[model samples]
Target: MNTSILFQNVKLGPFELKNRIVLPPLTRSRSTQPGNIPNDLMATYYGQRSGAGFMVTEGTQIEPRGQGYAWTPGIYSPEQIAGWKKVTETVHKEGGVIFAQLWHVGRVSHTTLQPGGGAPVAPSAIQAKAVKVFIETGPGQGTLADPSVPRELTTAEVKELVQLYAQAARNALEAGFDGVEIHCANGYLVNQFISAHSNKRTDEYGGSLANRLRFLREIVEAVSAVVGNDRLGVRFAPLFESTTEERVYLGLVEEDPHQTYISAIKILEEVGIAYLSLAEADWENAPDLPEMFRKAVREAFSGRILYAGKYTVEKGVRMVELGYADLIAFGRPFIANPDLPQRIANNWPLNQVDPSSMYGGTEKGYIDYPRYAG
Candidate 1:
């Protein structure tokens, strides 16, 4: 047996994961259109990657207005729930633990992707600049478009969104998922509320940092009530350095990211959730998260910690060995190598990911990548 620490079994709340490798949530827009329903193809794709100790499904829209991309899946409708059941059943058959990532794009959306062509909703009326959202122009065709200006959410609507997140957690359990992870990262609905840049609300849900965090606190508490804190995880993209404009659009790259995120994490600690997934800046040549912040995170959060974004096997091993991360989520690497854990354990060569077929496509790049055959 491999003696690498990464290969050792670890406890994540009620579950004992077989290894520390995780398949992070990746948005592959292959869901069946017209309903944005998960399909058999998605099941096959996820089943192939079940060697992961933990898996999180793509950013599934929590409601109709929550979608920002073409062909992504949703968890609100009955048919969508049944469709995800197939995916969960397949992953369970392979002895893999999977979590559904509840998502709402919020202002990172085009009017075309909104319900009834309405403006996307946010904690404040703002447009996410320097970013593009995918929209289907015709069958089998799509193009990137600028995000539409979003309308501010009424205080009641914000509270209703918390209930929607809770309902999505219920749907995830009903669909046979092992747990659910809230997509609070990447300047989505939850992140927008947290960032002062986007959330310019005058209501109780905005202004002060505590007010900004109120939405996340409410959603976490509500969802935890439904799924139990042990079965819930929250993700955040905390970029401390502001090198790129896209990072500004995606994460809002808070002026004091360290303070904003550490404060957010303290709330998770209070709820005692299963795990905290932190996503670093992934763009090429992106600066590594400050060592100071990593140490702070370990000190603040008592639960298991996960880190994703452009991590290599050596880097992941180092993080785990240093006790900064309990799990390492592999995004692109997992996409090209379904048997990623085995390859890492054995030091085997990895398959290269195809950028052309990365998004919405047939099985070519989605599931056709060959496993190591030595």
Candidate 2:
């Protein structure tokens, strides 16, 4: 098998990865209920895929109102923090570095997942479309339902949310995670504030580009203060097109996506975080990000840059070799291939994910994927 740059050791902030292969944060609704807490089963699932040089936990809600889906784990509660400790300890035992992805779904949530059945909050009261949020119906059961209209968060509430982000970072550290990643991507809360289409607020959090970026800036400051900028990473989903795709809701495309994301990247640069993760659009036939934007990103951010979006091994190696990205993340592939880095290094056969058993399932699709026999 031909060797690739992806197989080489790389320095990601303070940690030395065995290779550049990364497992991006993937949401698997397998957490135990009653509190949406991480459990032994979830630990087993993450531990099985610890072969990656760096692993990011599934998107963990920072608070109850931040939850958009059913059965995902949280980082705010005492039990949730303890539950996550098992995952981090297990990954460490396997000689892998893992980071907790701090997430807040914002308007992507439903009242069923909110506190006291209140409306999910966003920068504005706009309702999200073209996507479904998983809401628990009964014991161990969930359904994809349309998102409800969200209430615009007041300025005071926004500040409190920033503090909550800092607290989440503290909880992540308490859980023994090596680092944390602020989920500022994929049309979530931070993205909601950034996109002009969703944010109609006239306050400092909305309107002009500078105003739109305030929420993200505040979050970076808060999280970095607790986790230290060197141990923090921020992820952004920058989609340049709105072409119909399986998951259309992720694209918070703007008139000038290049400018929009460059500005966002510049903030990460100013904050001096460990790495910047840019998630490209995965929709079929989606327009590839222009070479110009990629060049701009390279110049704007001095720290390591990671890109994930249906990346192939050949593509990842080429990107790294060309200096476009320092690391690559394998999402769906990691789900079905526990020993993904080993398989990639040896060019072994990969398993196809069973879409039917992807979410809200037992160990069937989550932990039953066999490693390569070769």
Candidate 3:
């Protein structure tokens, strides 16, 4: 059989990947309650997908205040680190390299998801629209609520958050992760600081593009300082258009996404981080990352590049062959086929993902996926 481009081995910073396929960060909300810690089930879920060249744990909050949904895991406390140790140990035993994605939801959350039922925090005191946050409604079920009006972080508080990101990276190291990926995308905290719609301050951290990028720059610097540039990655979800109703989440598309993200990538390039993970829109018939943007990313950053968002094996191979992306992340496919990379390798049938069980559930759809036997 002629192997696809995704089957090729690649060097990603200090770690070398067995193939060009990656498991991108996904939010399953299966972490233990109260403490929001990773557990054995989560460990098994990740270990089952170890055939991928690399795996990034779901968006793990940097602090309790960082969480925006019920049951989402955190990487802040000692207990959380201990829980993640099991996950990392399992993946390592299978010879897989993994990175922990540190995240904060900013204003895209309800007060119910916040500490003391407090309002969610953001770059500005704006309420996010067209987005819903999952809150605990019962023992095993959750409900989606509209985001609450957020409190704008003062300049001092903003700086404090950067330190939190650094601390999270240190915690990830303690948890045995190979590296850390800064969740600077998806209308989250870092993205809120970058998007003009969410950040309306007149201070140094807002107004111009350079100012909007200040938070992300500071975060990358702080996290890299702890994890080293060779062990850090940044993710950015650049939405090019919002013509459809479904595309209005957090209303985050910049006036000029190409220029905005290109400049952001330039900052990452200057810092010499390990990789840049680009997340495209996942709706059906969504456009691919524009060729111009892809070229700009390749030219701006010297590190490895990863792309995600409803990617298929054929599309992944094509992107690799075109030199646009060094690795491809399959989200839904990985959910149903824990052995996704091996299945692709041997042309095995993939299990269909049950959308109902995607967010929070028991072991039924979480770790029950079968492996290919050829």
TM-score of each: 0.98, 0.98, 0.98
- Local accuracy by lDDT, each model: 0.93, 0.90, 0.90
Local accuracy of candidate 1 as per-residue lDDT tens digits, 271-338: 99999999888888888899999999999999999999899888998899888999999999999999
Worst 10 residues of 1 by lDDT: 242-251
Query: Alpha-carbon error at 232 in model 3, in Å?
Result: 0.5
Candidate 3: residue 350 lDDT (0-100)? 87
Error of 3 at 119 (Å): 1.0
Best by lDDT: 1
Which tens-of-lDDT digit does each residue in 36-78 have in candidate 2? 8899998898899888888888899999999999898999999
Residue pairs in clash, model 1: none
The Cα error of candidate 1 at residue 348, in Å, is: 1.0
**Model 3, range 1-374, lDDT digits (tens) per residue?**
34467888899889889998889999999999879989999999999999999999999999878888899999999999999999999999999999999999999888888889898899999988878888899887788888899999999999999999999999999999999999988889999999998899999999999999999999999999999999999999998877564433467888899889999999999899999999888888887778888988898889999999988777877787778889899999999998888888888888898888898989988998777666
**Model 2 vs. true fold: TM:** 0.98
Model 1 lDDT at residue 331: 97
